[model samples]
Target: MLTLTEAASRKVAEIMSKQTDPVAGLRVFVQKGGCSGYSYGMSLAPEIGSGDWVGEFGGVKVLVDPESAPVLQGVRIDFVESLQGSGFAIENPNAVRSCGCGNSFETEGTAAEGSLPGEMSV
Candidate 1:
């Protein structure tokens, strides 16, 4: 349901390559409490969970928890670098509005509909 651009996938792989511990893949999820009501979070997952939606982009495995699935659907992730900075940028089609930081967003209806109760792992 989610797609990552080549730049994003490459960045993920580059980060995973330097990890000291085992990183099964990247875990992406939505959690409540951002300035715009929800925010995206990511981490190097240690293992895939029973109900996670898994996908591989540019050879980097991406794991999304069931709760975050709907909100993240149709989202496109890209990595960008410029004089300002370099980081993963998320463009979520479902979002009605987003905070200036971009990491936080608000969608139609209640964010609680697809947001995790708290920050959680895949």
Candidate 2:
């Protein structure tokens, strides 16, 4: 079960209210990039193709693609702000390992083969 904190829910609602397009929902995908080999991606999108699992949480709609669902199960999304900066954070209980940047995760049971938790050195 994917969940969102109150702050995240409000922020998402505000962002969606400003959109003019007819959207299927926000999408959560894991990409290979950033200081971590995996990064969380959010998109206020209007379209969804097949194999997209729609997750409705915190009174909003979110799309989690099939490939990413296992890695993201029981994850909680939260928004954090400090005097220095503000951003979204993830509380992933399933992660066996995570990068320092908090963008990547690797699970003990099903990590991709040869995929490191952090990005490649330049």
Candidate 3:
């Protein structure tokens, strides 16, 4: 399962509190696209699905679909503030290669073996 840093957890909780509707948790998923073959996506989920993997960190809930769980395993999310900007950053051990923006990555075997479809070599 993925983990969230203290700053990330705090930021999530803060965002959730400002929402008018009740938030089930933060949903993390992977979709086909990006220069590295896959891009990470996140949103505030309304509820958990039966097949979802649910976990809590620093008092905030996190939801992941089965399809993304394996790819996201051992991932770490942190909130960063810099002179350029402030946003969430992800560190994924399963990613053998990633794009310059860090929002997309390619896992081992999938892209290395030329099995990835419509994915550009980085």
Candidate 4:
């Protein structure tokens, strides 16, 4: 399951209030690219794909495509602020190595359907 910290939930609610789009939810996806082997992408869209998993926390909605859900499972989302930054962060249990930017990851997770988990520990 995906988890959201209190700060993250508030941040998500704030963002939802700002968006005019009638989205199904916040879409989270992973693809094969980035400094690491994989990169995560998120957006608010009008529809959810057939393979997407939809979840909610504190009345805010989040979506993850099936392809990305396994890799993202058991992850925590947090909001943080500092002199240099204010943004969302992902705490994923399945990543073996993440890039310096923290936006990309490489792991042997079960990111594929019907496949054995990779060299990652979830």
- After superposition, candidate 3 runs with Cα above 4 Å error: 112-122
Cα shift from native, residue 17, model 4 (Å)? 1.2
Q: Global lDDT of each model?
A: 0.86, 0.74, 0.87, 0.75
Ranking by TM-score: 3, 1, 4, 2
- Residues 40-77 of candidate 1: C-alpha lDDT, one tens digit per residue: 89999999999999999999999999878878889998
Q: Locate the minimum summed-lDDT window of 10 residues in model 4.
A: 110-119
| Location of the lowest summed lDDT over 10 successive residues in candidate 1 | 112-121
TM-score: which is higher, 2 or 3? 3
Clashing residue pairs for model 3: none
TM-score of predicted structure 2: 0.78
TM-score of 3: 0.88
lDDT of 3 by residue, 1-122 (tens): 99999999999999999999989999988887889888889999999978899989999999998777877889999999999999999999889999997778998856765434333557
Residue 117 of model 2: what lDDT?
32
Deviation (Å) of 42 in candidate 2? 1.2
TM-score of each: 0.88, 0.78, 0.88, 0.82
Candidate ordering by lDDT (highest first): 3, 1, 4, 2
- Each candidate's number of clashing pairs is 0, 0, 0, 2
Q: How close is candidate 4 to the true structure, as a TM-score?
A: 0.82
Model 3, residue 5: C-alpha shift (Å): 0.6
